[model samples]
Every structure is written in structure tokens, then in C-alpha cells.
Target: MPLTRRSVMDAAAARFGWRRAYGTTTEVDALLTEQSETAYTASASHAELATAKNHDALAVQPGVLDVRGRILADVLYLEGVLTGARNRGLPSEVIERLEDVVDHGHELTVLLADAVRATAAAHTAGR
Candidate 1:
């Protein structure tokens, strides 16, 4: 079937909201590059957000939205710390460790979101 207006709106809005709100495409890409394997979780979270099916799984997407928002705060804070440390010429090891912190944070948020979505989907199916 062809997509409805609301469906189209939902997909585009969900993606734009995540990128513009939690991260910018360019910034996140650069972070991942600088972070190497340390940015895996953030990269995964970004990938999950890019999936339109994930958005359509929930009616409003509030659960994932909240999870992402909360995580974004912590991730951004950690990134800031890493940036400061790097600017000060801190060791690459220390910066990588900071990126690890951000990675764990992103992992936590994505896991929570997945759990919430699973519960929500089950509830909806049971009804």
C-alpha cells in the first residue's frame, strides 16, 4: 500500500528529530571516526534511529524518544569531556577511555529503548 501522509511524516520526523536533537550527522560521523571502535554504541544507536521500521513499531515512539533523549545528555557530556581532554593534549588512551564511556551510555539507552518497544509491542498484540 502507498504510505499515508501521517506515515511519511512520522518516518521523516523521527529521523530528523533524532539527528537534529541528539546529534548532527556530520558531528556524529566525526565522533565515530575519532572514537574508532569506542563509538560503536553511538554508531549503533544512530543506525537504529535510522530504521523506519523501528519508528513504525510504536504509535508515538515516546518510549524510544525518552530513552534516546536521556542518553544523549550523558553522551554529549562525555563527548565534551573527551574533547576537552584531547584539546589539552591528553593521551590517546585517556581519550579512548572517554569514548568508551560514551559508548556504554549509548548502549544503555538503546537497550532500554528496545526493551520498552518489545513490551509495548507485546501489549499491543495482546489487546
Candidate 2:
């Protein structure tokens, strides 16, 4: 199966034991769940506003909306993990890895934004 955000995050959760140093897996899970929900809500709201403002080109693209939401959620989750890892004073290597993950997540957001802009420009030009 293609890797969805949840799957990647689940793998991350299982792979990282850093959370155990500061809190139970259950606590980490709860934090992730909350962050994911918040991210999704924010993404949906932004999508709706964009659509209402005649920027529905990106929204209408196949799989783009879902990917955007997933990216937002994944970034939020990774940010939470990174924060926790720092607060717990995890080893430098682990902290570095978490930082990398967070940075990659931000990169994904930038790519998605570029896609959205390209789609919008194309749509406008075709009008």
C-alpha cells in the first residue's frame, strides 16, 4: 500500500523510543492524535476559504486536497514529536533525526504550495 501520512507517522512512532524516555507511548499517541486533528481542521478550513475565494483549482485537482491535508497533519505531528524530544533532552543523534523529519515535512508543504500556485496560474490563464 502507498504510504499515507498515518502510516508514516505510525512507523515513526514505532521506530522512535525517545518518547519512552519522557512519557508513555500512550501519552505520545494522545498528543499525536490531538495534533493531527488540529492540523486537519486547520487544513480544511483553509481549503474552504480558498475555494470560496475562487481558488478552487487546487481543490479540484485529483488527490491534491487529500495530500495537502495529510502533509499538514504530518508536519504538525512531527513538530510535536520534535518538541517533546528536545524537552526530554534526547540524544543529539535522535534530536537531529527528529529535526530532519520536521524539516522534510516543511519541505513537503513548500512543494504543495508550489503545486497549488502552478495549478491556479494555469487555471487562470485558461480562462
Candidate 3:
């Protein structure tokens, strides 16, 4: 389904436990708003934002109208691992891979953040 402002705000509210003003378009606007007003905004690019923040903990597309896609993806990954382990059906290799992923979740976030920042920087530069 196409993403909508309501859906994004609802997801944010559910995940962050923030009481959203339904259909008011506040959360969606905050995330989607352009960063043209901040002083020194050009100096600090999107890459900088990604580098400064924990991207893995944050959504993959933090600037998008929908900010929950990345978090939900991580949740799904965890669920898959849990299901595999619970069934004792996880292959040794798969289990080892999962262990690595779990252990490096933070690192993965950093990596993702860097990539995002780079993409943002390119986008900003092009415009």
C-alpha cells in the first residue's frame, strides 16, 4: 500500500508511545519537512546527520514520510531468528550468522547511517 501521512504518524506513535494528534499531519510534517531553515544547515549535510545519529536504531529513511520501515525490518529479522531457534531447526551456520548480526546490531546501525548520510549528501549536492 502507498504510504500516507496518517500511517506514518500512527506508526511513530505506536513505536515511540507518543500520543499523536490523529490526521493532524504533525509527525509526518516534522519528518518530511525540508531543512532549509536551520542556520549552517548546508555545512552540516545529511551524511552528517546520519553519522551523528544511531541509524540502526532510527529508521533507514529518517527523512521519508514513513519512518517505521527500517525499524519494522529489524523487528522482522529478530522474529525470524527467534522462530528458527525455538524450533531447534536453525542450521549451525544460520545460527552463527544470526549471532553475528545480533552482536553487531549497533555496528550495522552505524554502517547504515553512514550510507544514508552519503546518499543524502549526494542528493543535497545535486540540488
lDDT of each: 0.71, 0.75, 0.60
- Which is the better candidate, 2 or 3, if ranked by lDDT? 2
Runs of candidate 2 with Cα error greater than 4 angstroms are: 1-62
C-alpha TM-scores of all predictions: 0.44, 0.52, 0.27
Model 3: residue 22 alpha-carbon error in angstroms: 43
Model 3 per-residue lDDT tens digits across residues 88-125: 97677767777667656645556656666776776667
Best prediction by TM-score:
2
Q: Any idea what lDDT model 1 has?
A: 0.71
Off by over 4 Å in 3: 1-61, 64-72, 110-127
Summarize candidate 2's per-residue lDDT along 10-96 as a digit string, tens digits.
Answer: 678779743223257775676677789989987877766656765456445546657887988988998998899999999999899
Sorted by lDDT (best first), the order is: 2, 1, 3
Off by over 4 Å in 1: 1-68
- TM-score of model 1 (CA atoms): 0.44
